[model samples]
Target: MEFCDECGSMMKAGEGEDHWVCDSCGYEKGRDPEAEEAMETTQGQEVSEIIDTSDVEDKGLPTTTVHCPECGNDRAYWYMQQIRSADESETRFFVCTECEHKWREDDH
Candidate 1:
């Protein structure tokens, strides 16, 4: 997760994974062994229980009585996302249960 000092962009591993290089500004930095050990990610360090939901349709999402313009379905699964600024309201997304149509509603 090294960042480029020149352009403030994320850097990637260079040739042979010996150094980090910024693609945007062509900046390179040698990898430190001590820093690499400290920066080791904790991903996959522990195994968590995985629930299989292959038989579920909506993946346990809540449903609402939203109108689907594509298939005229009255029932749809809804979720909210912060697509706009933090001060503004979150955008409401709807997926029709019958026809799987997707749509979004914003507080304009």
Candidate 2:
């Protein structure tokens, strides 16, 4: 069994692939050589496609109704989708709906 880098969960090796998958955290690691190459190429392309959200209008973005659990700000709180994997890796951000305070949701 292998360990997920993100969540540190034990992963069982798949039958055909050399990769291991963590069932508890849904983390997949050790991709096939071809797949890894393709992913690398895709990542290079994505670097050029990064968008500046600061230029977007307030009305254009989807607002979530959750209050800032940290700041008690009710009027404008950013709702970020956190992707947590079995290896304990997570990516989350917060964009205050009212204050426009762009920050990582878990930074606090």
Candidate 3:
């Protein structure tokens, strides 16, 4: 792509189409009747920005005095989950160690 006024580097096309070679100082030069067009890249524009926070700080998950049909609270914060069948039995789930209130006990 033409650029080697005796070693400024970057030419390369010679073997006589009228000469050009200069891959760093083999300096030939003389082939430019227009022919240099290859450099293209395009793809930029994406932004989704989303933020939601309920701020939880519970870090304690195994307690159980159970009984908090919504704030009746007598301790609670358990877990069991297998959600049915593996020969059924494991779905206890609760959570109210003072009203963080969440429940789930069904197996009938």
Candidate 4:
């Protein structure tokens, strides 16, 4: 991506053009988007140990409908945790009823 040197704003290319024009300061620069194409990168990531409770026979936890990423179960058990700052909302936890796959989502 090209940026303006005068105003430090992002620069854009015009139709049938070979230069980048600054939207803020009108500064122009040469651009070759094909040579600057982004390449995807991947690396081996370690899986951390997680506590799963799908096999435990407990009926006290609240149950909800959620698609399980592991076993494709539509029903799951849920809980909430305040795993953030005091001002932030709680994180909702879910465990698949069939496969016990655990996941969480933060309250917006």
TM-score of each: 0.45, 0.32, 0.21, 0.46
> Which candidate achieves the best TM-score against the true structure?
4
lDDT of 3 by residue, 47-71 (tens): 2221111122255467868678876
Q: Write the per-residue lDDT of candidate 1 for residues 15-79, one digit (tens) a residue.
A: 99999999999999988878778775664623332223333363887889978889998998877
Query: Per-residue lDDT tens digits of candidate 2, residues 1-108?
Result: 357898898888766778788888888877566754565334664465444557345536655655665465654433344245557755555556555566665566
Which is the winner by TM-score between candidate 1 and candidate 2? 1
- Residue 91: error of model 2 in Å? 2.4
RMSD to the hidden true structure, all candidates: 9.3, 10.6, 20.0, 9.0
The ten-residue window of minimal lDDT in model 1 covers 45-54
Error of 1 at 39 (Å): 23
Expressed as tens digits, the lDDT of each residue in 19-104 for candidate 4 is 88887877887877677766444443212323446454465788888788778889988887666677989778887778777788
Order the candidates by TM-score, highest first — what do you get? Answer: 4, 1, 2, 3
Estimate candidate 1's alpha-carbon lDDT, on a 0 to 1 scale: 0.76
lDDT of each structure? 0.76, 0.60, 0.63, 0.72
The top-ranked prediction according to lDDT is 1
- Model 1, 73: alpha-carbon shift in Å? 0.9
Candidate 1: give the clashing pairs: none
